[model samples]
Target: MDKSSGTVGVFTAADVAVFSVMLAVSVGIGVYSSYLELRYRSRALRQVITGALLINICIYMSFCLYAPSLALATVTNLSTSASILIVGTICTFYITIGGVRAVVYNDVPQTVLMFLGVLIVVLLVCKETVGAAEVWEAAGEGSRLEFFNMDPSPYVRHTFFSTIVLGAFVMLYWVGVSQAPHQRFISVSTLPTAQG
Candidate 1:
């Protein structure tokens, strides 16, 4: 990064190399995991989850690909549909061969990339706007920080008690009783490890 221009606008060769290597490593991990895949059980729960997950994938795959497709289209001649097809195919290919194990492994790097991407955007915003402090101060001066609403009125969109209670219930349902979480839990070996 060069800040001599009063801003970090360029990605250096080292940055490119690091990003390229990280992606290559992540893909290598994913492919290696595919070779290690093993067959698992058959159950009604799995069948039901598969049907629901397919419907979700159909809807969310478009949502997930839209932003990236726009970005790719901006820089390349690739159309949005083509970009989506390429990405979707690559994703489906991995899951086809590796089962959930590949997803579990690939998720580690994907999550890292997601966080790193957000962090880079945030840092750039901070840099462009002078500093994080000023940006935060501006936000705090607005309705953004007015999160704690103690009003018990039903007309209120969000309230402190309602938020806390509903959030707790949602968390409980997802963490303890959700099929997705259950699948993750059972993915691990041993009862104690699964519980943990």
Candidate 2:
């Protein structure tokens, strides 16, 4: 996809297959972790889970580091790899000092800003293209807004069953295993406060 225009986004069948497989694997790992937590109640298993989560966070952060470099490289006419390294180093240093509390606290404003940014972009796109109706018309013409596909083949890119069922499982796994949200749920100091 082109980073500058934002008009080259494309997802092939192979992309869908890879995404589905990765989602399935993530869900499976989350389930296994939950089972281990419940059955054995082992501290070692908890530590392992924590380590795995940290590794995932680092991988995500690496990707995040690269994303901004795309824009910075275009703006400054510098090498993308160099921009990525600079941004990544700064991020690594910030994360090392900031820790989990810092991450959690920053997420609120980050989420808000992201939503506002998307809203602004969508509004601008609609304005530039004349209206939102044209956008929907184009999507419908391209058959890109399908609500359901009854295809039963597992190899199919996107079926109703695959979207609804697999999507739910993926979300459930994310919420169940992710430490940031989980910590918020358990942060109350009192049972009454938690219940409330």
Candidate 3:
């Protein structure tokens, strides 16, 4: 079983029901807007979608490679839901105020530092697990080593099909819909610089 329940469990049936409604409504709106943007030949809309897709891909890859193994009993599994809403709100606020350039500049060093930290933890995990060769063999014994070991379904992270679909949705939302990201265009000194 999932083992997560009550507060620890991110989604209950009620939550799923609400989320399903929200998702359908939001997606319908997004699709309509995207159609309008494309019909109008809106460059700004195109750029935002493209940029969001790029960001999503980067994050997804990071999760695949850097995420620590988690079971139902893991600390994060228990606390993720409580923290996620607050964290997401804060992130949105910061991004909205800081604009695109600020976000990108801040993320550059953050990404570097995050990767460094991940590297250190991975080394430590390796040391604790077994000899390097044995570790590789052990990992290979599980499907974790397989790039697409998980089922290629929407339920999984990013199947070959879902990536394009979800990635496009993410791109459209980030580029076309987000006010904060578009603010960067006007915040810049000149149109050429903003375009760049």
lDDT of 2 by residue, 50-141 (tens): 68978987897678777898888989978998998878787778868975456656776899999999999989989999699998899899
Instruction: Show model 1 residue runs off by greater than 4 Å.
Output: 1-57, 65-67, 176-178, 190-196
TM-score of 2: 0.60
lDDT of 1 by residue, 45-159 (tens): 3455457656865676678777777887778999888887877787779878987656655666898999999999999999999799988988988856667899987677778
RMSD versus native structure for model 3: 15.9
Model 2 steric clash pairs: none
Ranked candidates, highest lDDT first: 2, 1, 3
| Order by TM-score, highest first | 2, 1, 3
Cα RMSD, each candidate: 19.5, 14.0, 15.9
Q: How accurate is candidate 1 locally (lDDT)?
A: 0.60
Top candidate, metric lDDT? 2
Q: Which pairs clash in the backbone of model 1? A: none
Report the C-alpha displacement of residue 173, candidate 3, in angstroms. 2.1
